[model samples]
Target: MMKESLCEVNNLGLRYHRGESAILQGLSLSLFKGEIVGIRGENGAGKSSLLKAIAGLLPYQEGEIRMPKEVRKGLSYLPQDLSLYDSLTALENLIFYGKIQGIPGRLLKTRGNWLLEELGLSQKSREKLSALSGGMKRRVHLASALMLRPSILLLDEPTVGCDEESYHRIRDLLLKMKQQGTGMLLISHGRGELEDLADRILTLEQGKLREKCISSD
Candidate 1:
């Protein structure tokens, strides 16, 4: 039996200005539950734009995006840049995001603590974000995104600036999420990691998407 698609983008097109070239043109893609789909492209190739559109942070001018409302309900996004509050501690940031996602305070506290511990940041949870190393801050950002156990996760260059240990930690967390039926669209320029981790690889070039098989070595 074939797996059902969790997300579908049909004939999608987006342009920054009217009558200008489309950043994403006639693109169609699908992600199935429990699958990790990697998106690869050069700079200015609209990879991030595609992710933003899927996350509903950007509007497309044409085509349709079909996703289960339930799956989108707690959809999480980690943009290429950090989204945490600089003045907030890692635990506080997770709590804040959990509240925004409507998670109960009691559950938020449990999950936030577990996440920090899993990400190797339990010791630093009380420290302000301003004092964190880049890698530590990125881990906190990722933990914030995982607070709600989102059904669908959109990660844009999540491993950027990550140290080896942090990179493996994030990778393991993503794999664990995939096993728990969380669909993901991971945008990255790192071909080696993409090849190893992505179940299906999509390459965007000149406003088009093409599927490529990746050997997970």
Candidate 2:
């Protein structure tokens, strides 16, 4: 049986400004439920642009991005910056995002604690983002992203600063999400990470997307 495609991008194109060379062109891909699609590219290859377009953060100049009706409301974006409020504690940060995602106070508290513990940040839960190490902050940011139980997770350089334990924890979490019928589109610089986690790999180069060969397990 074929799994449903949670995300579809057909002939997608994007540019920095009018008449400028396109950063991405004729890009097409689909993210099916329980699947992880890994994307690789050189700097300024439009990987980020592609994610932003699917996330509706950037306006595409051509083509379409289609999400399943059921998934339309359940998508999450984790950009390279891992945005978090510098002044807020890890727990406070998750709670803030949970509220933004419409999670009730009680549920937010429960899920937030679970995520922090799962990601190895429970002990630092009360530490402000400014005080946490880069890896710890990244983990906190990820905890916030998962707090809402999103159906599709869009990741851009999500493992940049993670240590071995945090890296393993995140990989496990992503797999867990896949088992739960979530689709993922991941942009990563680490070839090994992509090989271990991705069901398929794609590369963006010269303003187009094409299949990239990855070593088998």
Clashes in predicted model 2: 0
Q: Write the per-residue lDDT of candidate 2 for residues 1-217, one digit (tens) a residue.
A: 8778898899988898999999888888988888888999899888998888998899988999998776978889999987899899999999999999999887988999999988878888888889988778878877888987988999999899788877888898888888998889999997599988988899889878888656363
Please name the candidate that would achieve the greatest TM-score relative to the true structure.
1
Candidate 2: lDDT over CA atoms?
A: 0.87
| C-alpha lDDT of all candidate models, in order | 0.90, 0.87
True-structure RMSD for candidate 2: 1.7
Report clashes for each candidate as comma-separated counts: 0, 0
* TM-score of candidate 1 against the unseen true structure: 0.96
Model 1: pairs clashing at backbone N, Cα or C within 3 Å: none
Expressed as tens digits, the lDDT of each residue in 1-217 for candidate 1 is 7887889999999999998999999999988889999999889999999989999999999999999898889689999899999899989999999999999988988999999998889999999999999988889989999998988999999989999888988888889998999999999876588876799899899999989976453
What TM-score does each of the candidates earn?
Answer: 0.96, 0.94
